[model samples]
Target: MKRNIKRIIFVVAAVAVWVGAFFMTQRLLEPKYMDDLIEGALTAEYYDETTKHDVIFIGDCEVYENFSPVTLWENYGITSYIRGNAQQLIWQSYYLLEDTLRYEKPEFVVFNVLSMKYGEPQSEEYNRLTLDGMELSPVKIKAVEASMTEDEELITYIFPILRYHSRWNQLKSEDFEYFFKKDKISHNGFIMRADVRPATTFPEPEPLADYTLPATCWEYLDKMAALCKENDIELILIKAPSLYPVWYDQWDEQIVEYAQKNGLAYINLLDKCDEIGIDFYSPETADTYDRGLHLNLSGAEKLSNYFGGWLCSNYQITDHRNDPDISAVYSEKSADYYAMKEDQLRELSEFGELKSY
Candidate 1:
């Protein structure tokens, strides 16, 4: 009996040490992990807390790629942000809106309808969670506690263990300090892009005969639409800019139906491109040439600026023009816009506008 008690005591001490170390590693490494990956893991917690925008754009990856919050702040005086991800389908958008409404009372929240049409709820890999979602910053904790549903609040957004399957790999490393080191986060809180170069190209996705909505999506969407109505926030639904041929059949019609039914403003830029003469087809316009699933920076500028100008017409927001500090942050970002403009201006000046123009 005495020998058994000693063995039990030793086991208890070992367990105590292990628990202490795991928490120690997690606490020490948390800042760096947030700097590196939180933007993609947690939403509703991190992004919206630091976000001080008059307008916040939420959707799927289409929102991030196509909207430059800097440009929105610079040109129109309206502060905006893209809280988008790769697989933020319609249902997730509903939850996100519910989450955002807890703290941020932006003048307008833009929703991209692409994922509303094609994204899958079970396909979490494709689900886009932003640094905004995972931030454990003091504000992040409050945002999660105040805004999110008990399930998302407890599982995915705050703790993040339920969302990222790969986190265990970090735990297994030998030198595996749980801490990540990052040089910076932006003044306005979007993680600054470390590299000026373009991200890897994705191949054009194959066309599907019939694009269908996931059954789980309708409930969240219904909730989101109702939430906007109740709060009196103008919910603008846009069929985000994508290549025409790639957009396939009745895409606009389906989104249009949703928009009209919800009394949301819908912008179909594909159809609007006729008035603007920005061709989504033609190799010259599509610099990446990967068959139109994604656009190079040049294409993104045309689309973003066009949509930016269009969005400004509806909302009244703060002008960031006089903010020299904000200008400093954007100077490096202007490279993408400058490069794109050079091509467009040179093309226009040399040929006096192409067959498209």
Candidate 2:
């Protein structure tokens, strides 16, 4: 009996130690986006949201940097969140929509058509930015499988330590500080940048032998639409007004035809720049932070205001600003939003550019 009791205690202690060691190693090896590479932190922040959004925006930087959910709520009483990252792919977007449905179903799911340009996984660095923060689940597993490049391994995503363990020698103070918890990096998934860089000339897009979006891209779009349909949600597709990367007429026609065939609403904001008050040609009305690739805070507010008004007028989305509970939550969010803006402006003034953004 004494030997058996000792043996049981030994096993229990061994298991506890192993579990603790595994978690600690995981924490140490994980990327802490508190410092640089903050886009990496955006994906995981959605889980921390306490209030359910009426609208959810899912895509790459085009959606996140171009639309401000804070502006949407403040201007139209529409609560929204953007699940976006750098160079997010179409398959990743579809799986993200699938994962989002596991939370609360929103009235509208807005996806940027820019991701449709790529048919296959682009890079491992981009894949990590979008997928590393997602929780361990079948949805995440599928996203990993769909987003991983040829050189990437599934085990690295499952056990991130395998991917980042080498960074032990280069771990910064942020790695230790944010190991257990991280500061909120976005206002409703909008990474606010206050600086302005006017659009300049770019090399003309090289003509593609094929203007047709990849069949695989269309497959994911169908999946996203079907998933939204299953939940009785309307999916709205839009092309954000990024001046570079030159959105072609051929691509626009394909998206327009798809939307018409499926009875979905598709808006090409690039065509509505004048109506939306976004001026890429004028330095006085500059809206982008990195030339014309992404919108800054000023442009995002303008786009969100226009889009919100359109949404309220067209869709069944309601003005929740009067709801005391929801209003209270947004009131706090508004405070944080302005605070971040002020900080960014201050940083720009001091350095002639935004350092943190």
Best by lDDT: 2
Residues 1-357, candidate 2: write the lDDT tens digits.
Answer: 999999999999999999899889889878887899999999999999888988999999999899999889988899999998899999999998888888899999999999899998999989999999998899999999988889999999999989998998988999889878899889989989888888889997899899999999999999999999999999999999998888999999999999999999999999999999987656755888888998889999999999999899898888899999999989999999999999998998899877777
Q: Which candidate is the best by TM-score?
A: 2
TM-score of each: 0.63, 0.98
How does each model score on lDDT? Answer: 0.54, 0.91
Q: Give the 10-residue window scoring lowest on summed lDDT in candidate 1.
A: 187-196
Clashes of 2: 0
Residue 74 CA error for candidate 1 (Å)?
Answer: 1.8
lDDT tens readout by residue for model 1, 1-357: 999999999999999999787656544433333334444543533342343556667776566555555555556655665666555666556656655666677778788777655433333333334333343555345434433433453345554433544555554332244344332222222322211222233457686776765454556566667787788777787766555335545666766787788778888765765554444445444422234444444555566567667776665655666777655545554564455446556665676552221
Supply the TM-score for candidate 1. 0.63
Which stretches in model 2 have alpha-carbon errors above 4 Å? none
Cα displacement (angstroms), candidate 2, residue 66, comes to 0.6
